[model samples]
Target: MEMDVVAASELQRGGWDVVVIGSGFGSLFFLHSYLKRHPDHRILVLEWGASHSRQWQVDHQTNSAVDYQTTISNHGEKDWNFSIGLGGGTNCWQGMTARMHPHDFELKSRYGVGLDWPISYDDIAEYYDLAETVMNVAGAPDAGKVFPRSAPFPQQQHHLSRTERLIKADRPDTFFAAPQAKLTSNVGTRGACCNNGTCSLCPTGARFYAIEDMADIWEAPNLTICTGARVREIDFSGPIAKAVLFESEGREYRAEADLIVLGANGIHSPFILQQSGILGGDPGSYLGEKMLTFVEIMLDGMDHFDGGTATTGFELSYIDGEFRSRHGAVQYWTNNSFLWGGLRLDPPGRHRQVFPIGITVEDLLYKENAVVDTGNKYPVIEHSGFSDYAMKGLDFAISKIPEVFSSLPIESVELRRVLPTADHIHGSLRMGDDPTTSVVDSSQLHHHLRNLLVVGTSVFPTTSWAVPSLTCAAMSLKVGATI
Candidate 1:
């Protein structure tokens, strides 16, 4: 079946059974699962930007053309780094996929800090398996029971680069092969990983991009994807969502649906809710509050950049422990690519010897650090400074790196606090048991509007010290089962 790409102007009014607001991992996986159960139902997906194929990305030398606005806050100016095309950020992701540690869900109980997630790891563990299989995850067999997987990975782990091997050989307990969404063997139409370090722009379609992974569903007769459709407002009457009003090519259009699912990114999801005037009373008070992201610290070391997947190894030993009571949980990983382009080191071989290691610190959610509409076309980010706990975790993680890599004969180690570029934004429109403190319930439905479901990391109550794509995918699949 060929996927129909229709213009917003062409869509007939008031016929859709379900309307998905974004084409990212969350929306794509929701469509994939929902269509499997409700195959003949009328489904429509509205994407804000144009679709780009792998070939198109290669030819254009860019993954997305959507203009994402910068987030301004006390933390200073920063790019949200979200792609707004058919596949959304999956098109530009580095492919690292790991489940949030079980402890991440029960933060309040264990650490006496942060809010507990309404759902636990046990509730969504199977969904994680389903998502990993769909993404063709390649992970270490020896990853142990740290994340508590019921089944092994779908494919064998990718071979570690020489640098990764050295680090693992020295600290086997601390270092393990990082689980990634890229394939290790041929899987249906998708090809195997070709060891091309540039996963952000994978030419072989080996890495899992939502557009490629859900190609079959996108091509299904039941689904219709509308590109360049900028959803301006979600019109509602009482508790029911009536229609979605959007703009395309300078013309306004409306498409009605029985149910609406908002899978837009964290920033945009809340922004849309606010714009639509369906965010309950005091929208800004809780809807866009408590924005969270990982704080990264870079460590430069010697003889380490042996190119492979960008992130081939990670240290999970520090993910949780007594340290959590005082500071945030920490996780570190080695970067396989020497991406410092155009900068010529004074000495020739120094560039090859410099490897970047990143330490991720869990950010505490604060009401002051938030996303506000402020009458701007895009949301204004009023980010707060890092908590004392996060800073302590960063300092602790930096000090431990030298000991963990002591056997590598590292020559020079430089520690610098890099800007928040992990792109794992969370906590806007968070889900909680209380309606006053949260925007959505455990089922990810809007507390006020029962028909509206908001999937993705935006519903996360806390930020864990891991990549959030896999967890977001799992959450989408779980929501699909309910609907």
Candidate 2:
């Protein structure tokens, strides 16, 4: 491998410039930008999961060699889904890549709901374009006009279904093509979307896998990658971080670095920080998201799965409104999978009946809903439930959903059961201008330890209805370039 990977035992103490925990989107994107600025800097990446190749995943029909449930001990009713392998969440993420609305940054200031992010949309807009280009994001040509993109998506969006075309004809601006990393057109070694209905382990490498596109960053000679290494804690003294203590292959090892970057997702990152007793603030708190699913019965026999990708439509008709003040705003994603997400078997003869939609609601952080450290790789989920704001948002969205499609075909909408988990974890280490209310700063730097940075969605100040991977990647690029 060109990326100079090594075993954890090969790690030397106090000899690295930067030590990045986890080899997911956040870590790789940061390294991609950071290495461009400081080419000769020695880097070390420690991943908790096995290094399974793309072909291995396809053949095995699973993302990781490590079973996610076995990795985390969940005592609560909520289930948090994430991959614990070389590519991290990138191996298992649905390809949706929507940006946070411009107003999302100033939720507290503008909408009087949720906390405002320390950074503004203008501050990271360019980085969003950069992240999209790197991932070869296929999206609507007119996508993100309200969010206000400086540049268009790298690839044109896939063809919408016939029914969706009619829906767009009514209000083209409300519903835009889903911004996704799945290639609509081929790019170098990456192939176009085969639309085979299986995306997590795409058969033709259509979906954006960090391993395929970011191999250069992984194989860089200065960078050393160590898989099957789970970071347990950060070793810091007063105001400076010294090293990371991790477990690998039944043995505990210490890897020291001048700077430490914790990108181990919302749950694990906070667990490590809390265990270390870092001076910034509480690392593991407010860990929950609102998730619900619904099925729309197309009375006129309209086809639903004709879109090019799994999730082809984003229901923007209900999101980003004045309703966010009292209750949270919801993100509705049209599930375009006839085989998996959008099928009604019970109502036999009528095959093309459901226009399946998945809903994600924004929730204010609750201290009670948290992860407690059990000194194991698995975190104890103390999540009670979604906030009343989130529940209210769901109620409002469910009520308005029928009206959204009211202009289209006549059908009976069946509100499905509320999902136990959205699988997208948020708010373990919040970022803000004030250290009193946050764990990291707008720059993603630790207030107490300047040499330490908490990257990824874990540092999110407020959870938005948007999928966090895109914004997380943008934040990685922004802070990665500067540091």
Candidate 3:
């Protein structure tokens, strides 16, 4: 299993029903669904990083479960950390899951801003159901009118932290609900979530870590997973992606497959496609553009509340297109008063300190805004100009800060640093019916390459208030069904 391809004597050949490029949530979900539905199918999953849960080693250049001193990406010996391991980023993600609002699917037509998704919320609602079931999501029923669903949530939602309750009591206008990912009870093979506070690295393994979930599916006779396999390029015999080229233990190898899926996150997905020449005139043209990272504003202040996690509750009043509905919905994340609540405070004659309050809004970015350029094999971001409207929306988000946490007796609340924040990158290969404006179609089939499908958030036209894992999982389910 730990064969080095670059050092192999013969060009190895293996066949599979499907070969997945990355092991992120998108990849895991799709593979799970595929194996579940078509148990006869053969799945070969190649992860570039080492197997974190079962490995004694960890990567140094890039922080992966794999214990490697060098970086996995082609950009250089050091650059970004795209998890090439078994569980992918989910191994280290804060398990915050929410579905994209209906409007997010129709961003272009609704606001005349970006391109529209070929599919709509109606098309993928069931997949959301599947995601919730698998993750054992502890979210309340659909009290929010915006997310209209025919069926009640499978399980009851979670309870708000004590800090969240206080914040809501102070800011009645802002509603707070227990986030949906960490569970109040167990769903299936996954265990009940013990509020370890370290949900990002839930050592107890109770939280819905996708790697753990998928590992169970691997027990099925048809599925096979290879860790420490870093995919360098997606090989295509014409438009159809024939094989995925990857490296393991200082050597390169290729896994030929009938179908291929790219679940690499926003940063690395485009990097792989560009390296493979998929962006030239057809799918490639729209491959690396139309990028959207939610504009995140981190405001800090002092509060007496317990310093726990930063994000606990959220407000959707801004999302239904209310006060600034015309501008689109804004999301709010609550910080632990001691932690997030005090990130901005000038400590009592204090030394410097920083806390990440977790509340966030899903604001839009200009489509033609930026590109990921690898210079000297190092990822260099070339950001485009921010639209005036985007700036105004950001300002609006800032102006309404006091409405959420009035208790934070702020000595002085100042902007820390406005930056692009997205756990999931989207829109490089947007989905649409036409080839001119998009890269993939409703089925996630690339517009130009009929047989090639680009999975994950790369198909999103705009960022949404919801975390993308659920949405991306739902979309991949739909894609797998068609394939």
lDDT of 2 at 122: 91
Better of 2 and 3 by lDDT: 2
Q: What is the TM-score of each candidate against the true structure?
A: 0.91, 0.96, 0.79
Residues 372-463, model 1: lDDT tens digits: 87776767776645677777877787777677776565665666445545677678888888888888889988888888888888888888
Clash totals, every prediction: 0, 2, 24
Worst-scoring 10-residue span by lDDT in model 3: 287-296
By TM-score, who's the top model here?
2
Residue runs of model 3 more than 4 Å from their true location after superposition: 1-14, 54-82, 142-144, 161-163, 166-174, 186-196, 280-310, 322-328, 337-359, 363-380, 385-388, 403-420
CA lDDT, every model vs. true structure: 0.77, 0.81, 0.58
What would the per-residue lDDT of candidate 3 be over residues 375-435, giving only the tens digit for each residue?
3342333333334444565566667766655554434444544443344555666677876
Better of 1 and 3 by lDDT: 1
* Residue 156 lDDT in candidate 2: 91
